[model samples]
Target chain A: MVTYIWVFFVIVGSFFTIFTGNVEALNNEILKGGADGLKLLSEMLPLLVLWTGIMQVAEDSKILELFSNLVRPFLCKLFPSLPKNHPALGYIASNICANALGLGSAATPFGLKAMECLQEDNPCKDTATEAMITFLVLNTGGVTIVPTTVIALRLMHGSANPSEIIITSILATLCSNVSGLIYDYFKRRKKHG
Target chain B: MANFLVPIFVLGIILYAFKQKVNIYESFLVGAKDGLVTTFKIAPAVIAMVFATNIFLNSHFLDFVFSYFTPFLEAVGIPNSILPMAMVRPISGTASLAIMSNIFELYGPDSFVGRLASNLQGCTDTTIYVLALYFSSIKVTKTKHALSAGLFADFVGIVAAFIITFLFFG
Candidate 1:
């Protein structure tokens, strides 16, 4: 509810600014920005295909399963309702894997599949399940090591050292993931308690 | 070179393990098929999001917001170059990528703002798009709480990115 309100304000605010002609420079900005965006996307294709192929190989070889097993103990602690071998675990692993590589497009299927698998065990038709809540937390704060997408954008923009942001990216993701996990923990505790 | 070699070695080991047991090519093809299907399913929403971002940006509204939020952003250690990104981050990844590229072009990659903007781009997401698509696909009718929670997470991401960048690059 409050979120919608904030969005409404943001929209109205942006429009108000536009109406005041405060953004007349945007015409040229968009023209330049769009071209650059397309170029970046083009350059990103090879990397995206490479990572997608690697992820496919990972899935085919059950390396994803292996990864899931490694994370299962911690995930189980976070999401008690999810059974030991729930399909959502695989989807979650894939989603996390794609995200770590900074492949947001590639992460979508895995996220959707994870949610679907979670829905299987959701007793309440309307309320989000514990698994769903936890998955949301993980998705929102998923660790991103390479941040390939951003690096690609940097490369497109002619950044000399596109990879320099790797350390900061990792740190920020770690913080977000930790905070998300902590928030979920207390939220769940409060709900049950 | 070592950075590039590591990933190749990892892939090679995985392939070697699967040799003679499973048809690696066939399995990969199957997975690719699934990937293509998922891509198509989400294409419409992604396109709509891209279009919306284009409109918002072209309308010049984002610039105004950036100006308005300049002081607050600076207070948080975010440079002006990264401000456009902060505005676009919640709108569309593609649009944000475009903005990022422009920044990189105007200011070389090593420039503080360019680097920070690029990093922040990776760290955050198109929160509105994610909320709409994820909730809709799952038939989530009332998105009140989810929206609030997701945006709150995005806010944290923005602040975290600024702080991390400042600490590491400042």
Candidate 2:
């Protein structure tokens, strides 16, 4: 799926640029594209390292166990396919908690771990399960509470009220999450019913 | 308020680790090393995403497409400047962030456009990127309903961002 999209972008973009007589600019952009990837990697590297380390501590200290236990009931309701005390639920809870706190980089490892756990139980190795899809929906909806990065960017850009968007962000994310979950619920029902 | 969250979180982790008799330093190193490996694992996908997204964005196709919607957006109280950000947001996080920071620099963060940009940025994760990374990590090539559902969420999030921004900051 991503393969098709990736190819579409490169092929269609190049063709469009050629037709628009921006072929030279497109040439420059294609080169810059790879460099931009490296730039992004550099930017994400430190944050990923720091958060994963902290998350590792949380895991070792059983902090994740505590956190997951706190959210387990709710997660069980959301992911009924999984067993009540499944390890994936713990990872999923940790992922959601990290996302809520706006620790996106920290959330990735937990999410990946959750996926790995889900895969362990998946009968079909190549296909995603209903539980996996539901988790993806929730993860993509994001449901961030603080939006720390946005606030920080605003502050850096000299906004008079850097955190003003926080409330709106939370509200908007809630709306997205609700709508996404509702959609997923109905779709799942249709599949089973 | 947002500033204290990370510090407090770290402190909480440290205190909890101490009480649990966990060697925080060793655990952290182990996790950090895993993180570096994860980074490498995802680097190829990330690079491909960035490269392709940049090519598409640089093609200015979105700009061309959005030009037609400018007047309608303005009429609906949405700023024309943010359309591109909203469009590419689900595809690439860094691209949207760059657009958002540009909006911040140009209009200042207190402006309506700025607030909308911030809300858009916060409302969702990069759906395509997340799907690619997570699925690839597990080697799940058949994504089933995940992509459609994730994009649906992003669509709703974008609309919610626009509407909520207007209600709050318009």
Candidate 3:
């Protein structure tokens, strides 16, 4: 899917630029894009390192487990197919908590771990299960409360009220999450009904 | 208030770790090392995405596409510069962030467009990227309804971001 999108971008972008007589700008972007990518990577590197390190403390100290226990009952209601004490639930809980706090780098590890656990019990190795689909929906909806990265960028740009959008972001993401879950629930019901 | 949230959260994690009798320094180093490996692993994807998105943006196709909606957008109070950001947001986070930053630079962050960009950025994750990565990690080729649900969520998020921003800051 992403393959098609990437190709579309490259082909259509080039054609459009040529047709629009912006071949010069196209040339510049193509020449500079790789460097831009690297620069972006560098900027993200330190933050990822620091947050993952802190998150590791959260994991090793069993804080994640405690957090998971706190959220497990609610999560079990969402992912009913899973066992009551599945390890995947713990990972999923940690992932969601990290994501809500806007620690995306930290969330990826737990997310991958959650997938690994889910794959262990998956009936079809090549197909996603209903629980997996539900998890993906919740994950993609991104119930972020802080949006730390956006605020950081706003601060970098010297915004007078860098964090002003936090409440609005939370509200918007809540709407996304609720609607996505509702859609997923109905689809799941239709599939296995 | 929001500015203090992250610092307080980080401190709480650290304090909790200490209370748990965890070796905070060693654990951090281990996780940080893993983070480095993960960064290297995802760098190729990030680079590829950035290269493609940069070309797409440089082509000004979004401007051409959005030109038709300029009058309507103006009437609705949506900035013309934000159309691409909202559209590309669920496809790529880095690309969206770049656009948000551009909006901030063009119109100060307090500006309505800047607030909209920030709300848009926080409204959803990169659906395609997350789906691709998570599914491939487990070798799941048949994604079923995950894509549709995720994209649906993104659509809702985008609309919600716009409406919420207008209500709050417009």
Write out the backbone clash pairs for model 1: A159-B109
Instruction: Report the lDDT of model 2 for residue B167.
Output: 90
Residue B101 local lDDT, model 3: 92
DockQ class, candidate 2? medium
> Taking the tens digit of each residue's C-alpha lDDT, what string does model 1 give over B1-170?
32464476457636753863656766666656655554445444444444345555556556766788778868976556577777677666766777778777787677777767766776766767666556555655554245555556666777888787777777
Top candidate by TM-score: 2
Candidate 3 lDDT at A13 equals: 90
Q: For residues B65-90, write the lDDT of model 2, one tens digit per residue.
A: 89999899889876677989998889
Q: Write the per-residue lDDT of candidate 3 for residues B40-109, one digit (tens) a residue.
A: 7667776777788778767878889999999998998777879888888877787789889999999889
Cα deviation of B131, candidate 2, in Å: 1.1
After superposition, the stretches of candidate 3 with alpha carbons farther than 4 Å from their true spots are: A23-60, A153-162, B1-43, B105-107, B137-139
- In terms of lDDT, model 2 sits at 0.87
Indicate whether candidate 1 or candidate 2 has the larger lDDT: 2
After superposition, the stretches of candidate 1 with alpha carbons farther than 4 Å from their true spots are: A1-63, A156-160, B1-44, B70-81
Q: Lowest summed lDDT over 10 consecutive residues: which window, candidate 3 chain B?
A: B1-10
Weakest 10 consecutive residues, lDDT, candidate 2 chain A?
A43-52
